[model samples]
Target chain A: EPEVTQTPSHQVTQMGQEVILRCVPISNHLYFYWYRQILGQKVEFLVSFYNNEISEKSEIFDDQFSVERPDGSNFTLKIRSTKLEDSAMYFCASNLRQGGNQPQHFGDGTRLSIL
Target chain B: AQTVTQSQPEMSVQEAETVTLSCTYDTSESDYYLFWYKQPPSRQMILVIRQEAYKQQNATENRFSVNFQKAAKSFSLKISDSQLGDAAMYFCAYRRSAGNTGKLIFGQGTTLQVKP
Candidate 1:
């Protein structure tokens, strides 16, 4: 089965540096999302992207976060400045339809570590 | 806003036995979706099963099944013939069924241990 794929399985950066996490969603999928999980914490929704725009975002998705669909299959999340608290596992998910009821397929998360 | 709750932080089951994980949610929306996801050591979030709020009958996928109580706002997962491979962190999630928004609200997660 086709699945979402992410690059740079692990990322390490300094506290003030920027980091971009990349994802290649399922080819036919239309909706994409980003979620993060702090170690030993629940997975939290960060943002959702559709039609080349952000559809929804959580309070956790603040000014430092931005998402882009630079190409047909690539969905990238960039953090302008990293903090120790920003270190977590980030997951990329995609669904075939935009409906909330559709099941989303997830990619193995990219573990972000801030020094 | 919707909130999913998984009260159990951890659970263990004997190999080949059965186990059940509990989940509850608070949502005013009449139509919605509930899901169970498994995150193994690899940290890959895998969809285990899902239930639609409109469906009165519970959903079953092979050894995995759900007890969905729409009126009570509860959705629980039951794993039959549990195996060692089933050991993982299980998360319960809720999603609104309307509009173009597809964000998932996930619970804190229950870590399951299958003992041999």
Candidate 2:
């Protein structure tokens, strides 16, 4: 099975610095999404992208957070002026079709630790 | 707002036995989707099983099965003949069947321990 792959399984960044997390969704998948899971907390949706633009985002996805499909395969999440609260495991996911009926495949996840 | 709840923080079962993890959700929308994801010690999120709200029959994947009660808004996962590999943190998630942007709303998770 084709799986979503994330780069830099672990990332340590200083506060107030910018960090970019990269993901390569399954080659044929159409929709892409980003989710955050703070230790001991439920996973929270960050943003969802489709057709090269953001389709939806959660309140947690503030102005400091942005997502882009730099190319046909790469989907990147960039955080500006990171904070301690930003430390969490970030998961990238993709689905072959629209709607919730289709299962979303997940990546191994990137652990972002902020100092 | 839709919220998924996993009341059991942790559960234990002996190898070769059976165990069930509980999950409930608060949602007014009649149509939606439910899923079970397992995060082992390696911390990789793997899909276990999924059930569609519209389907009257429960979803099953080999040893993994779901008991879905749409009216009660309850979805639980049952592991039959459990094995040591089943030990992990299990999460119950919900997604709306309607919208195009299908972001999953997840539960806090339940840690399952299998003793050999």
Compute each candidate's TM-score over C-alphas: 0.98, 0.98
Give the runs in model 1 whose Cα sits over 4 Å from its true position.
none
Q: Candidate 1 at residue A37, lDDT? A: 96
DockQ of all candidates, in order? 0.80, 0.79
Model 1 chain B poorest ten-residue lDDT run:
B94-103
Tell me, by DockQ, which candidate is best.
Answer: 1
What is the alpha-carbon RMSD of candidate 2 to the true structure?
0.9
lDDT of 2 by residue, A25-107 (tens): 99999999999999988899999999999999999999999999998999999999899999999999999886866888899
**TM-score quality measure for candidate 1:** 0.98
Worst 10 residues of 2 chain A by lDDT: A96-105
Error of 1 at B94 (Å): 0.3
B56-111 in candidate 1: lDDT tens per residue? Answer: 99999999999998889999999999999999999999988887478899999999
TM-score of the A chain in model 1:
0.97
Task: After the best TM-score superposition of candidate 1, give how far the Cα of residue A100 lies from its true spot, in angstroms.
Answer: 5.4
Total backbone collisions, model 1: 0
Q: After best superposition, candidate 1 residue B30: deviation in angstroms? A: 0.9
